[model samples]
Target: MSPAHVLEPTYDTLRRRLLMGAWPAGQRLEAARLAADLGVSITPVRDSLNRLTGERLIVSQPGDGFHVPRLDEAGLRGLLDWHHAIVTMALGRERAGRPDEFQLTGGDLPERSAHLFASLVARARDEELDWAIENAAARLGRFRHHEAAVLAEADKDVGAIERMMDEADSPGLRAAIDYHHDRRRSAVDQLIAASRGGQII
Candidate 1:
């Protein structure tokens, strides 16, 4: 593994802290502060923040610094809806056709996984209306690191889930949905646990 692998875990740990209301919204991200806390360089922190920005978990302000986005009811619902819609659409048998093989072999991943995550992020960028609402309580300064971590896991599962997705006619879609949802729920719990450690809040 590369040296970067050691730092990758920081991204998820940081993102969750921001999401769980530890930092709140509209706060500045001090690179020096994070470096001191995480015992890493500033580069990783900056990279982590950029990743979070794509997720709409944090907003980047030109002069005001990085802010935890403000998410209202509609905004939160929109993200939740988008997540459900995309997962349903791509994995639903009715839409994507026959199921591909579900494979999670070791080694390099395919481009499809990157594409799906990018698409989810693109939906957020296309609109500012729902951007801040769902992530309102996030501590933007903290989660840049954690975002990277989540993306890594999500990246790994993306292709397998898409390939395994059942056609509407098949009985597999429901099971796939349940399987993916359970994984996501576990991730959420891990996020919450990491966030509430009182480092940011």
Candidate 2:
């Protein structure tokens, strides 16, 4: 709606479109056109895009307008490394000896692992998710650009990413991190191959 929220409906709309790969990387986006496309005025769109730019999901050239931020292998690895460190520090056995070690809370990951992951994936398709605990996964554009790559390359170890979050072995967790990368690389590779052939995976 209006620009009051500055980052809600407008931001969400853009993030989802990006996650769906609706636009190619480096394609410039004009706020007015995007506003028209979203059926709203340019104000909200500008504000929303500003927020994404702050998150490094969009880039603003000196005079070339705004475009989706493209990620290289280095950028991808940086994000994955953050995931590994955060997950390990927050839930690692060495740190707190596992959140599971403490018996409480109303969460049911062990019982509803598949359902939760599925829901997360669906939400991902519709919008962005923070993938952090305290934040409870708010929609943010940071991960959308990498979704296709993560999914395609990550197929071989989908189960393991879930396992790393659920299991508490230090070594296993470490392996799961690498496995996560291999899977994403696989997914990205497939997407790239398809792209080269003028198709999508």
Candidate 3:
């Protein structure tokens, strides 16, 4: 297979793992170890790591290897704020036309939440905006499971968002989006603490 073919799967697998909080924040990633685990060569692993670093999913030091980023309170809050802003913008654009249909696919709240926001952004049909929202979602993915613990009836909130999307209720959707993000923003400290404690769901 070509190098790109070899690298694509490795990159995707690593990205998924990172987004899913497979490794704890701040833990160093060893290319060799990951290569062995994935049954690939170190070159592909290193290349994948570099790609993730650029995406801000992995942090790279000058002399040190790549590591999973640790989202502190301020950092997490900033991401949430940025995500909410762009999502709000996307919602505005989407409202200009008939909202595009999207299917939510995930077994858990975190995955469902990510898919929900992604669907919202996708409806806007702006590549740049889509990229922005997706990046934020990836960074926020690890902490989403904590939402279940911190926010009451988190699943209900997601269900409501889905319902609004289905009914094309733009105003209610916007309000629900605000409420969802605001609730998470208010509980950032608790979310970060739960993540640090390695509590998933």
The ten-residue window of minimal lDDT in model 1 covers 136-145
Clashing pairs in 2: 152-187, 153-183, 153-184, 153-186, 153-187, 154-183, 154-184
Indicate whether candidate 1 or candidate 3 has the larger TM-score: 3
lDDT of 1: 0.49
Q: What TM-score, computed on C-alpha atoms, does each candidate reach?
A: 0.44, 0.61, 0.91
Give the per-residue lDDT of model 3 (tens digit) for 1-201: 329989999999998887777777788999999999999999999999988899999899989889888888899989999999998888777746566676768688888988888888888789999999889998898788668778889899889898788655457888899999888998888877776775534
Cα lDDT tens digits for candidate 2, 83-124: 444444443323332232222223222223223333323322
Q: What is the overall TM-score of model 3 with all chains considered together?
A: 0.91
Residue pairs with colliding backbones in model 3 are none
- lDDT score at residue 160, model 2, on the 0-100 scale: 55
lDDT of 3 at 164: 86
lDDT of 1 by residue, 45-64 (tens): 87787787887677787776
State the weakest 10-residue window (summed lDDT) of model 3: 192-201
Query: Each model's C-alpha lDDT?
Result: 0.49, 0.51, 0.85
- Best-to-worst order by lDDT is 3, 2, 1
What lDDT does candidate 1 reach at residue 36? 76
Better of 2 and 3 by lDDT: 3
